[model samples]
Target: MVRRHWINLNGMWDYLITDSRILPWQFYKSEYFPFDGQILVPFSPEAPLSQVKRQLLPDETLWYSRTIQLPENCLNTESQRLLLHFGAVDQICSVYINRKFVTYHKGGYLPFTTDITDFITEDLTVSILISVHDFSDTSYHARGKQQLKRGGMFYTAQSGIWQTVWMEIVPNKYIRDVRVTPDWDNSLVRMRIRVSSASSAENASPAHISPTAADQTDSQGTVLAFSPDRQNSSNVICKVYPPVFLEADGLNDTLCQDEITTAAIRPGKGATLSIPENMQKSWTPKEPWLYPYSLEYGKDRILGYFALRKCDVQIADDNYPRFFLNNQPYFQSGVLDQGYWPDGLYTAPSDEALIYDIRAMKDLGFNMLRKHGKIETDRWYFHCDRMGMLVWQDMPNGGSSYHHWFVTYLATLLNWMRIPVKDLHARLLSRTDEFGRQEYIDDIRDMVRTLYNHPSIVTWVPFNEGWGQFSTKKVTDFIHRLDPSRLVDSASGWFDQGCGDINSLHYYFLGLPVPESDRVLALSEFGGYSLRLPEHSACKNIYGYKKFTTSEALTDSFSRLMENTIVPSVKKGYSATVFTQLSDIEEETNGLITYDRKKIKMNPLIVQKWNTKLKKSLHS
Candidate 1:
């Protein structure tokens, strides 16, 4: 969701690194802490684009300082409140305004906001300060694929702010959040809009609002006004537009059409709007239709969008369980997207860079992407929604050091021998710490809540390759309760606990085989065929399941794998297959594209041709 009145605070900011023992309050007490350099906002210090070119250690603290002058019209203090928003900060952070501590946040993957209405001076100038600390992979803090040593699968560690920072001015009583759920089978859309109370309580939780009995009607006999169940409820208005087609410039001509429906309600409950059959459009990879809507509450307004689609698993005519999208069997030809960049590390260098990665895969005939072991910026999912791409979101893994002998080497050997392994050994899997396990649960809740509204996400992957895997049934049940709309891959790679909607498998060096199970079958990870271009490679030490000397050899081998193994298995029962990766990351050279994104390592036409063949095999 987005608002019209907001300022993007993304530019250069003064930065300083200090020992973790140094207290943030010391800066308020006239203590001298010199900000030695400037780093780009929304880019971690470890990223090349940040201009710091330094890694923040576990025992160090990264501090940021900036100042902004508010707009002249924003001085209506009695009616308006200023809210500061941070997309994400690594590990943990403390925020301050005008040298006074405001709030503290943990968990780096989700967003946090602070109401800084009282911190602005009379001149409308505000000084902001933020301090961050990241443990990286040194401890159990959900650090996904980030290692201090930084080699092989793990890459460099980054700290401080790694996402956008912004601010917005809103009325005292305003809408805080909006959640949209589409019911394609019923042709209805349900919404829950949370609105703030008139009280000036700082950071108080918003009250939910639902529609009450209709109090008034328009000349067309439509319910245009509704009364609130509670006396303090805010007057809310909703306008839902027809589905629009996205284009190169923006939304196409269909968006200019008159709104299909309008409803007025109050805070504290939910509302459902029915879409007429003629106006209803099912969202799919070939036709990514979206309905734009606006919510007006008191003096606040926000614009958002949603899609009508459904994802499930059902038995097809062949008497085999398969993945279904909108009541039809759909083969998910996907790629493993790590969401890394040569310049920005975790963050993409630009919005266009993120779009390029998604668009490139779609052009190559891939309909889905497994976001491996990391959460991305909201913009990435937004593009996926608008571009008609399916997503499997993985929760970032964190725990003490994993036992390679148990989780990797022995597990792989046992898997090849057709032996099933359970995730009961908490110590070996690095999930023994009670605090760490609770923190992992908290991280899961935050991740789902933050990304629940995205239509592109079809699966929730809790564990990957046995990293910090524990209580598979319990965690899967928790996710199901949180969101029953999507499928769950409780354990992606090694430890299949006989739960979840799919029996997911990973094949690197081993030959591909379709596992016989009552649930859907998915090759979650495979095809690590490497072709390194020296000029575009990030590191000389190459790592992949299969090494190729040239593009022709790699493309030919991939085609053979698809035509012989993948396509045939799809016809039998295989529902989905994810190629090892979208691009090279650090020392891992098993990607269709190079790390710099400057060159393609495989033949694009051959890749697209095989992908089309693989998808068509499900029905053939």
Candidate 2:
């Protein structure tokens, strides 16, 4: 149930940076703090728009305050339940409404919901205060590329409220969350939904079962899904609504939820439910097809959709592994998307912005996005689910001391020289970085739980470039145990403990080479070939693999990289390749698009022609 009328708790908020040794003597709802002035919501303090453009020291904690009037309906609801939702809050967040502490959430990225119904009053105002502290890469936490002092590869630091804030109203009994997993092998989709009843006891059973008019999608279709355990029981029968056609108008028209497609339901098992064979649709980047099912469950409702697709790795003729999607081997063309924005930094401005990145890349013939370092907002994964873009999600690296000078030079350099570089390898061999190790484990558990539902996410990468390197086998096993649906890439760049799905490689300031015989080879990072558009560039001190002065040279070099290295090698054995980046990030100029997104460094046709050539080569 998407709420439409609730006020956005985003925008301007009162904030205070304090070294407080004591709690506020008397704090209340909607009350202002000692006004340290206003800040833009959803943008970190370190960002340009966050107003307080200063980084919080490790010892210091940030305080924030804001007041909002409770809506008339919130206080007067028949069920008398009001729910507040925080799309995401960094590190940790303690929430309050009307001067009472209600809940707190830990984890840098992932949504949390709270119940504020019992605390609501007609004349009451909603009050909130939050605190945030981050050490970024300094201390071992999922810091991604954030550092106190930013330079090559690492960008600005971001903190506090970088996601949406909103509220929702629901009846005494309503759906809380739904886990939808689609299985093409059985032509079935699984739904495990939770419902909450406002008046019921804390752990009481839900009010009722069986969905009603409230069960729906934006397409005006009724909701219905199969209950595998009760399949033979015709107790619940459904008729599909209208069909949605989005491609006719292309980018100009918004794609509306056209209809509710219903399926049979059984109680517990997945085998009982069956999807008609003809209705099955395969999802691919070129033709990303998503079928929405407006699921109904006894009056309460939520939107659910799934794509019919299969991804697996199989031994090929050349003895190297190949990636097959929907039974066909397709070479994966990917870009390293940090998922950062100029305005929001770690977060995108809106859901549309996230979808646009995938669509834009798809239009240029790429199929995958290697999410670099950071785990993204769930909405980002939702966009990927409905849009048909494959993802290689990374677990943000955080741990004891990174060997910047030695690791990259000795390990990565010597690997190119075919020399094994090992001092002791993994965190087990190093005793000093205990804090980094524990933090890594904590973040990994949070990552798997948060991103488990998205189908587009096909792989999980735990570490990159030997940053805070630790136990590879243990971490890899943990991720697989959490969700075996997708592939796992244990180590992205260097310090290979000889575990994981793809034998990944990072090739920058170098050339792509044919991989060895055995594992599925992925050129995880390469072709940083760059061209600077002076008018649109961030600055002159930027870096890239090879600097090109002209579009012709850049495009020619890119084409050569594909024709000679990528395309030929893909045909031989390689399954996927990750280009250096999607956009020019701060100091990194080797991006397909300029920093501001105002200019395309290479002509679209040049890229398209080569992509098409590669596609044809793979099929041939």
Candidate 3:
């Protein structure tokens, strides 16, 4: 969710890393605490861009302090409220304003906000402090692909804030959340808008989408009520605009567009907006169409956008269960996107850097990206949505150290032997922590809630390569309950439970095979051909499934792999193929591009030609 009016709180900030035994609040209240050198905000301490190239150990606590003077317009008034937002903070964090605790949040990937109107002083000067503690891989927290001892596929572990921190002003009574569900089969869109008031209880019951007009409640369960005598007795009005086919440069004004249809509905209730056949524009990777809309409740208004498109698996004319986009058989040529940077680690250097990655992949003819083992920021998803790139999002994996001999070596052997291994061995998979398992479930809910509005995401991948895998069928069922709209890859790579919509397989050391299954077939991971350029590499050590010495050799191998194996498999019921990776990370040289993003290891024309062949093979 993005706001038009907000202040970014990113820059130099006073920071200190201390022993976990030191009480930050006690020292803050006493007005005396040792301060360390300044570290760049938002970038973790371990990141090179943060200027302080140091890692926050598990036993250490990272503290960030800064002073902010609020604008007069943002100061709390009778009708306005001030809210502070953190895009994300690793593991756990606590916030203090004016030496008093305001809020605490857990989970590292999703955004959290707190109302700080009451904490504002008369002079509009606020002293803010944040303390963060990240257990990294030592605990059962949801740390994705981050390792204390980094090497091979795993990268350096980073802690503290790794995303934007900002503030915004909103009405006392505001739209808390909005969910847009596109009913493509019915040619309509369903919207669920939740509104909250200052007078309501702090903790209210969760709002469920119902056809009938019911009381409106915020995401946190606060009921939204208005007096009978209040003006505009109609609770809420929703206006949906016609779909716009905009050029890449025209996306900046999407939120300020005009509407074509209006519907009045009670808050928290579902309202369907039918799209006329003449105005219906299906969103695709070639032409991503977006329909903007605004929700107005009294003086509060918020804008959002959605696309009228559907993703499903259906038996095509070839009598194979193939991936379908907008009811037509489609072959997804995708790349495994790690979303990591050599400079920023978990974060990108700039917004343009994020866009560059998506655009670069698109230019290389990759229509989809399997965001592997990590959840990205909203801006990354926003770029994917607007750029028309389909996404398969993976839930970050977390648990104690896995038994590599069993989960990795043995699983690989089993996969090669075409023998299925049950995910019931929780201890072997390092999922024995009952509390950690529940936290993973909660993380799923939060991730879906935050990213549900994006139109580019087509699949949800719960488990990858048996990392922290447990209760595969049950987790797939839970994801279905959470969001039945998108397809789910219950278990990717190995340990298939014979569930989920896609029969996902990964091949690196073995030959690519056309799998026989009732579900859609996908080579979720394959073709890890690597060419490491020492000048652009993150480390001198090389790790890849297949090694190559030059760009020409890698490109030649890629062309043969696509033409001989992947393109031919499309006709044999392979609905999707995701290459090993888009870019190199740390010591892993199995990427099409180098770690610094300074070079594309393969010839673009050769890659594009093969990709074109993949697209045409679906119909041929």
- The TM-score, computed over Cα atoms with residue i paired to residue i, of candidate 1 is 0.94
lDDT by residue for model 2 over 137-217, one digit each (tens)?
Answer: 566666778877777778877777788887766555556654555666666555544456433332232223333454322
Candidate RMSDs in Å, in order, are 3.8, 6.1, 3.8
Q: What ranking of all candidate models by lDDT puts the best one first?
A: 1, 3, 2
* Candidate 1 lDDT tens digits, 230-277: 223355787779887665334334347788877765444545677878
Residue 231 local lDDT, model 3: 25
**In model 1, where do residues sit more than 4 Å from their true spots?**
24-33, 198-233, 247-255
10 residues in a row with least lDDT, candidate 2: 265-274
Candidate 1 vs 2: which has more lDDT: 1
Summarize candidate 3's per-residue lDDT along 425-458 as a digit string, tens digits. 8888899999999999999888888899999999
